[model samples]
Target: MTNPRQPHQPRQLSLNAFLHDTGHHEASWRHPESSAERAHDIEFYVEQAQKAEAAKLDGVFFADIPGLWAATPYRPTAHLEPITRLSAMAARTEKIGLIATASTTFHEPYNLARLFSSLDIISGGRAGWNIVTTQSEAVARNFSLATMPDPAERYARAQEFIDVVTKLWDSWEDDAVLADRDSGRYFDPDKVHAINHVGRFFQVEGALAAPRSPQGRPVYVQAGSSNEGRAFAARNAEAIFTAHQTLGDAQAFYDDIKSRAARFGRDPGHVKILPGISPFLGDTEQEAKELQQYFNELTVPAYGIGQLESLAGISLGHLELDERVPVELFAGSGDVLDNNRSRLQVVANIVERDRPTLRQLLHRLAGGRGHNVVAGTPLQVADIITEWFENGAADGFNVMPPLYPQLLDAFTAGVVPILQERGLFRTEYAGSTLRDHYGLPRPDSLYAATAAATTA
Candidate 1:
């Protein structure tokens, strides 16, 4: 019989570690325990993956941008390529899911398809692709465009980008390969096909070179919560990484995404929405707050001001740290607080609701770049997660530590056990593949489905 206490089924929460350099806190590198010097060390990342696996967390995510983010000079910006690093991680860890971000704007569909297919195979189906349309204007210029690609145009291209890539991944049927020595035959010619895809933004001849990867294709994960982004995710994403400051905000976004997915003829349960949470855990609430404050105090004011300006697309040089920002300042910024979509809106809500001083606002965003930042004891952190998970606010969370392995260690050791004892999270991994971890089904190959229909 199954262990009576063992975690079971569809009710469990899915957690992923958002592995940023050093930590999520802007001044984490300056922390005494931070491993800042090893920012570029491959083992630094490998260890993180291993640790998450040890805790039986669902996955580890690496978000990327083609060019330097506007605030590069403020923190440790140097890093290894995500796919390359993840491939290395795949070799070291056994069951942890490996998720890496790749831009639809920066790569050709075929090349991107092959890279993820290889990753899925390398990790025995423990791979996920975090699809993104590059948003920063500075990064766009690096690709030779004088300005950022329009969001609509970028997403349109992204739509086609996934279409073509999925076709390539579906090119070879799972059983297409048969190395029959006596029969002197290789893969069944009938089972492999060329896509012959042509679209508004991309045109490509079909037939991916590789056989269908372990999970058919990397599990489609996305992070945008914009009106456009939600539509895209409703049609494609299996998991979504998002930001939220309150339960109401999270619930509204959750309901919208689920409703949209149902409209697209999808099972709403298949689309897992995970908001980002950066926790500062300690023995007591006061200690947790102090820990958060220590990191905040180390941050540079100039960098925070510059970062705020860049992200919100506004000028803040004129505002004093202690003064309340004028509500009208964000009036023209599209849907800042009215809709919970953009980063600016997150800032707007903080300003409108908390009415925080400029310095307070900077410190708030400095922690997770608009993601929720919580400081509490382990039980408090677990309680927050439980409330959100049970109250229709989230399916899971992207766990971002304010500092590196130290914060990760605290979560796995301190918080996870509470979640486990409460039957909210798994104490051990149930399956090997990422899809198994999240309880998402493996998709049938498009070609296979077509052929099965014809036969019927």
Candidate 2:
């Protein structure tokens, strides 16, 4: 632990704990090791955040959907709004980044920007927004809409949304607040300016009510993998959270995103591409497989079928559980780079390569819903991380444990030490802000630049 690593290294791996209710496994709620009954408790989340911070992870992320999950009938489907819980977490922990999902389709830029700005200020610069275009019609209904917009229209609106929000965030300059008791002038009027944004999807005007946050602006993170999604990320996302099932697929995605970012006149290194990894660990390889099988056996067939049907846009009524799934079912998704249905393409690759039975496919998807799932010892998991990092397959990983506190604890305790010893990951955090943790600099304020130009 003392000398295996050098004093200085060019790049260190970034890791985030992708926290779900009980765990990432569809049947994890049924496992005895899980805290299934306490899903709604704020303390439950606080504990997880503390654990991740203790291990010096880059951050903790929460994926949100306004409506119930498709497999809600089989698991605990309720959730506390991520921002509310994270605000509480901000006060409890220091240094770890706080990221939460919010759909551009459902939120107006003004209110969303204000919300994140406040969180950034409150967290002392450790806030991130995982931008998403909610794809579910069910979720749209919650907002009193009849149907969700098509992907093209949604992405178009999101492009404008990002523009408006960032401008609003920069409405107040970095040194706007004066807080002078002697003069009684709280802020310099000259430092604040109206955004006055007008676009196809929105019209937001005036400066933000919240003062400039510590990071200047919150980090922009994107999770979509569609063609439009990639283009959006290339143009705007500072960090990207994605999923893949193989080294080849992951490597291709890594290269394509970096190249696309460069074409947009953006620094490719500024876009950190972190793929989701769900590993079930044990002391030995056989034990790991057995542990994974334990969770797989707990999955309800109906629930797994519903999840598959949703992702693949196909029905499985005709096929028996043990029968082979036809490769032709996913013929349209052959091009991984351009496929709008990002997750279905992962399943297609799985069926084409391994030729699994319907049941086996279900088991595979259950572990992480098309994210890479590995059942191995801590050493094996470390090898996977190292291989992907060294080979340009990933910048880092989104560690998703199969069960709460237990699996997460296992990862931080077992796998983290290995990563630290090899100098692939940081043994301790060196900075206070989320941007600092991700190796990103605070972005220059747009309004500030405009003011300086006007003065000149």
Top-scoring candidate (lDDT): 2
Tens-digit lDDT string for candidate 2 (321-353): 999999998888855343247788889889999
lDDT of 1: 0.89
Q: Which portions of model 1 miss their true places by more than 4 Å?
A: 1-10, 334-341
* Candidate 2 error regions (>4 Å): 1-8, 335-340
Each candidate structure's TM-score, on Cα atoms with residue i matched to residue i, is 0.96, 0.96
| Residue 33, model 2, lDDT | 68
Question: lDDT per model, in order?
Answer: 0.89, 0.89
Give the C-alpha miss distance for residue 275 in model 1, angstroms: 0.2
lDDT of 1 at 302: 91
Candidate 1 residue 218 C-alpha distance from true site, Å: 0.5
| Error in Å for residue 434 of model 1 | 0.5
lDDT, model 2: 0.89
